[model samples]
Target chain A: MYPWIWRHLPGPLPVRILEAVVLVAGVVALLMFVVFPWAEPKLPFNNVTTPQ
Target chain B: MDPPTEVIAPVDDYDDEYEDYDDEYYEDDDYYDDEDEQPAPPPDSTARKTVRTIGELLITAGLVILLFVVYEVYVTDLISAGKQDDATQALDDQWSSNTVATDPQREVKYDLLDGQAFAKMYIPVFGPDYKFSVVEGTTDKDLEIGPGHYKGTALPGEPGNFSVAGHRVGKGAPFNDLDLLNSCDAIVVETQTQWFVYRVLPMAGEAAGWAEKQANPKCAKVSPLGAPYDKTVGQEIVLPTQGEVISQVPHFTGEVPAAQQAALMTLTTCHPRFSDRQRLIVHAVLTMSYPKAPDFVPEEMKES
Candidate 1:
């Protein structure tokens, strides 16, 4: 699956590497700021207060 | 994948030089391309592709779970520390801007908005840097910024339980080291105009321990409480269902009345570190309170 993604990335090798880095960074940011914050309460071990 | 065959089918040609891609990171994809080497299909080729695909999926799943742990343990602490700093800055601004006051008798204001920080808590045993802003609400969002005071509970230095809640592990875990507190240790709370010093009560599992605690020189400032509140221990692990722990008199289980009550403070966090199965409750009573002067710092804050 990663190979297919690499083959289809719309750039040369260096550009593709940079794009991959940016893409990974974007995903990390999204998870850190948006998705993970939303999903934190649903997961165990985050409930520090009662009725967790 | 089949719908994108027009785009993906051409990748099989690239997969012929799989070493180039394998040198990068697509080592798993080389196995799928291995099947197309012979003109006709091998009997187990399809099974091989299925296994490889499942393996790739499992690897992705493992990476995702690892990322989640990183987010929970480190990233959340970083984020919450920044937020708690912002809250502290806001509190400082709020406290400094109260120069245009009306009644001098009213030192600290009690009417605070949700998530607004009203006081700062210091656990001396945690270190000289051990300080946390005590926010108004105990919601997950509120505690994310700092230790949160339960709504409707007594404010700092009041005649009822000034109960607070904080995280034990992450989200700037203000009470993470709560277990370190012992009998007669001080928990100082600084409001806008006054500093209230509360000490952990004797942990005899009953009210009878206060008389003995008061005899100690270190506990000289730590006052003894009357009937119901004397049962409150310095530290107790109780089920989360015990809302009475934050009541007017902890463990008393009585209706909210305006009668005179003990001036106590309770700090609660999850027990056993990361688990929320039970709550580790630490109760302290207000032993002394004095006006906050510009040059004054609480003595408890200097304890190593």
Candidate 2:
């Protein structure tokens, strides 16, 4: 999986490294802001309030 | 493949890469390196490729769930702390702009807009830095900003319960340490005008010392309840369905008896941290309320 990602990141050594960082950061941001918050209500994990 | 001088690939061009390793390993084997020593089996064998695919699939699944856990415990806290700070800052701005209304004679009405910060709660025992913005609603969205006040419950210093709900494990975890509070620890609430100081009631097995506990300087002003409320303790665990814990008299019904309706504050959070199967509730009774004064800090309000 990691090698696949490494392979897809285009450019020379320095440029590929920078792109990989950007790609990882983008994934983290998406999970943090959109995916996780959207999934919060659907998941039963952090149900703090009463069922009312 | 080349002059022995160029045996190693430049490490730059991708073509001559593992192609050489393949040739070197399999040049001799037909089945094994010792047998035909054939060219490194095309890139990778079907078996090796399948194994890699399965391994990657499991790793991807594991990482996604791990990321979700990280979002729940750490990411959400980061997001919500920023939100809580904003709410607190807005409330501070509003409070600072208010003209003095220090009249003990007249009644003061606290009208809190939905989702707005209406009060600030502090657990003196939790230390001076333990304050949280008390917003007006208990919905998840509202709580993401700070501890939320349960709607329809009493407001601060009122006659019934001023119930609040906060996350126990994440989203700022305003009540993460709630269980640590023992009998008679003061929980102070600051509104526009008054500082309502409350003290935790006796815990289940500690009620026998209610009188002795009240003798503490911090508890001196916190009076015990009568009848319907005499049994309510400082801490309890109730199922998520027990909404009655926020009633005018927790776990009790009937029109509130004027004498029995003690002004109380209830803090509810998910119990057994990181899980929400039950609720851990902390109940405190109003001990005293004084008009806000610049130099007047409550004795129970300690930094640490």
DockQ of each: 0.36, 0.47
- Structural RMSD, model 2: 11.3
Model 2, which residues run further than 4 Å from truth?
A: B1-39, B42-48, B100-106, B222-224
Cα lDDT tens digits for candidate 1, B1-304: 5678788877887787786766666656676678567557456677887887789889988887789889888888999999999999998998787763344765545658899898998888778788999999988889889999988888998889899999888787788889888878889999887899898887755345566766776588665455666567789898877777888888786664656687889988988887878899988988888877779987767865
Model 1 C-alpha lDDT per residue in residues A1-52, reported as the tens digit of each score: 6766788899788999998899889978887789888998987675656532
Give all candidates' CA lDDT scores: 0.81, 0.82
With candidate 2 superimposed using the best TM-score fit, by how many Å does residue B103's alpha carbon deviate from the native? 5.7
Candidate 1, which CAPRI tier? acceptable
Clash count per candidate: 1, 13
Off by over 4 Å in 1: A10-12, B1-44, B100-103, B205-216, B223-226, B255-259
Least accurate 10 contiguous residues by lDDT in model 1 chain B: B100-109
